[model samples]
Target: MKNVTIYTGPLCNFCDAAKRLLARNNVEYKEINIATVDGAMDEMITKANGKRTIPQIFFDDNHIGGYDDVRALEKENKLLELLK
Candidate 1:
């Protein structure tokens, strides 16, 4: 399976929703709390191709963008392929 990592901030509804979707799909992921980590937001942005948003998702070191992007992938039935 691909290594999924999510960069999120505290109390973010989108982040929580994204995590819930992943959980429902039984997707394993690493959650990084950018709120408490210095420089983590910057790193997330850099890795996400300048997307300065919370809940930046990565699939096996590949930036997959934010919650909407993830949901779109799921809608298109592409998320599971990436998970593998």
Candidate 2:
């Protein structure tokens, strides 16, 4: 499986939702809390192409965007393939 990373912040519903979705699929991920990690917020913004949102996810080196974007991939049946 590809390495999954999620950039998140405190009190974010989208982040929780995204995590639940991944858990349901048995996907393991590294979670980076921007509120607690130094310079993580800036790294997330850069990786997300300037989108300043919580739950910016990446599958390996490829950016999968936020919760809605990742959910869209799941809805379209492409998320698992991407992970593979």
Candidate 3:
């Protein structure tokens, strides 16, 4: 499986949902809480291409955006391919 990373914050339902989706798919991920870490939000923004949002996800080096974006990828049957 490819390495996954999620830049998240507390009290974010989207983040939780994204995590659940990844869990259901058995995609292990590294969760980075920006609220708890200094400079993390800046990194997330940079990685997300200036989209400052919670739950920014990455599969290997691919920025997968937020929960809705993730679900869309799964619906399109591309997520599994990325995981591989």
TM-score against native, each model: 0.94, 0.96, 0.94
Best by lDDT: 2
Model 1: residues with Cα > 4 Å off, grouped in runs:
none
- The CA lDDT at 82 in model 3 is 81
Query: What is the C-alpha local distance difference test score of each model?
Result: 0.93, 0.94, 0.92
lDDT of 3 by residue, 2-67 (tens): 999999999999999999999998889999999999999998999899999898999888888899
lDDT per residue for candidate 2 within 5-68, as digits (tens), equals 9999999999999999999988999999999999999999988899898899999988989999
Best candidate according to TM-score: 2
Relative to the true structure, candidate 1 reaches a TM of 0.94
> Which ranges of candidate 3 are over 4 A from the true structure?
none
Task: Return the clash pairs for model 3, or none.
Answer: none
